[model samples]
Target: MKAFVVYCHPSEDSFTRHVRDSFIKGVVDSGNEYELSDLYKMNFQTDMTEKEYLRDSNYRTTPGLAEDVLAEQRKINSSDAIVFIYPVFWTDVPAKLKGWFDRVWTYGFAYGEKSMKLLQKGLVLCTTGHTKSELKKYKLLESMEKVMLGDRLFKKVHDAEFIVFDGMTKACDLREKNWNKNLETAYQKGKNLFAPRS
Candidate 1:
């Protein structure tokens, strides 16, 4: 199977990067070909232009910007699975990563006329947070569901199996032993999710 991984993180040494790598390893071990788009590294822009909206009611009309959109569409079109790896910053994904969705998952390209469901075959979300578990428990889970799945992505894609593994506040865990274990488990979950169906 082909897999497309969208990684969102600014720091190269971050736990988010590790988790992304682990997922890639798992996919490779499973003998699947995959592609990756590292948002921060690639310098993805999340802003939507007014002119784009003015042009033909299509979200991606600019020629230069259209290329990026088409590239993402091709990746999505070619893949059987899609994974989003990022660290939850301020209760949301980074702006650059969000921009990838804004630019790539266009109205007509990624969705339209109930045809938008085309992108949802095998989608998974892998995320981490700087806040501790207690913090999340105390709060309302920071509305991750609404922000990530509901507003940004879920509705844009079709019906598919989705899961989350949130590793929190790893900075306090300097050694990262516990964090690594959690990441390993999450990687296993991702692997299982993409394993060939029986």
Candidate 2:
């Protein structure tokens, strides 16, 4: 199986980057193929043109999506699984990623007479400064999962998972303590991504 990994982060000096690399290593070791879209490195055009906004808003099935958007759609359709890796920004994905959705999830593609394939799995691997307990206490974790799995990945993938790499800020002592452990988990997740779906 092949996985399309959408990695969004502004810096190379981040735990999230490590997570991406480690996971990819595991995927390679497991003999699975992958395609990567590093949004920042690609300088992805996230903002939608007025024409696009109007087309989607009107539910128009006009086939004039931007080249970048079409490329991403092709990636989605060609892969068996999809993975999103990023740091949580205000209990949500980064603005670039969110805009990716706005532009790529176009009419007659992601919605209305959709042509996007239904992948076997959709996975979210997010880094957060807040501890998991804090996220749970306030139910922010649920909100995050709902946005990604319930809404965006809903009906888009057969199964989904939301992974939290919590307490990852420099201010948190756990950052150093849990760094390797978290990366190990990421590697394992990728290594087993297409392992009979168990």
Candidate 3:
């Protein structure tokens, strides 16, 4: 299997980067091919230009997608599975990632007689400052899952999963305690990404 990993983090020094590396290691160890898009490293253009906006709004498929957007679309088409790795900000994906969806999931591609390929899997691995209990108490975790799985990835993949490595705040003791465990889970997820559904 080939997995396309979309990793978005501002710094390489962070734990999220380690999560990414560990996951990739698992993919490699599993004998699967992988492609990575390090959004921060690429300095991807997130903001939608007016022309791009008009194109989507008007439902016109005149074929003027920017090269960057087309490149991302191509990656999606070529992959067997898609994985998104990021850190939660304000209970949502980072603006950079949100903008990636806004810009790259273009008209006639992600929607409107879509050209986007339906991948075998869509997996999201996000780090959160709040503990899972805290997020569940307020139903924030459900909201995040609904947005990512029910909305953004709806009908786009055969199966989808949303996993959070929670309690990652610097001041939280669990951050250190669960660090290795969380990464092991991430690696396992990658290793088993293409396993048959049971």
Candidate 4:
């Protein structure tokens, strides 16, 4: 299976990176082909310019990123599944990571105003947060789900799964344990999501 892992974290020595690496290890150990897109390492531009937005193009256009976006779109098109790993700040994704979305996931490629078939097949969201899981837990917190899965990623894509790992502020054995557990869980989920269909 081919998996595209999109990781978003500023600090290279951060706990988020640890989680990302562990997850990648699972994919490697499973003998699956994968691609890693590190937003920070790429120094991706996150904001869209007014003039670029004004253009009537269906796909996202940056000052100097037309070719790059096209390249990413081709990668996404070839992948069997996509994994987005990042640390949630203020209950949202990093600006650069979001920018990756704005720039790459274009209309004709990711979705269409008419046809609704998403170019990508499987979509998985593996995310972390600074706060504890209990604090952010809410019964009606489906907004993120809808936007990332239901609306954006899943709108064009068919099969999808949402997996989240919360609580990272308090660092200790407990945090490590939970994080590892979540990593294993996500790994297995990714394997299943990208498994070749019979």
Clashing pairs in 3: none
Residue-level lDDT of model 3, residues 95-119, one tens digit each, is 9999999999999999998999999
TM-score, one value per model: 0.78, 0.98, 0.98, 0.79
Tell me the tens digit of each residue's lDDT in model 2 across 1-198: 999999999999999999999999989999999999999999998788899999999999987778899999999999999999999999999999999999998889889899999999899999999999999999999999999999999999998999999999989999999999999999998999987665
What is the overall TM-score of model 3 with all chains considered together?
Answer: 0.98
Off by over 4 Å in 4: 56-65, 113-121, 130-140, 171-174, 196-198
Flag regions of model 3 displaced more than 4 Å.
Answer: none
Runs with alpha carbons beyond 4 Å of true place in candidate 2:
none
lDDT of 1 by residue, 1-198 (tens): 777888888888776677788778877877777899887777766776765556426543344546666777788777766777877666666778777776676655555533233454445554554434644686635576656656656655454444445545455553354677766765675566555445
Each model's backbone clash number? 2, 0, 0, 1
In angstroms, the error of model 1 at 35 is 0.6
lDDT for model 1, please. 0.64
The digit string of per-residue lDDT tens for model 4 on 122-165 reads: 55454544434443466323555566777657555556666666
Lowest summed lDDT over 10 consecutive residues: which window, candidate 1? 113-122
Clashing pairs in 2: none
What's the lDDT for residue 153 in model 1? 63
Candidate with best lDDT: 2
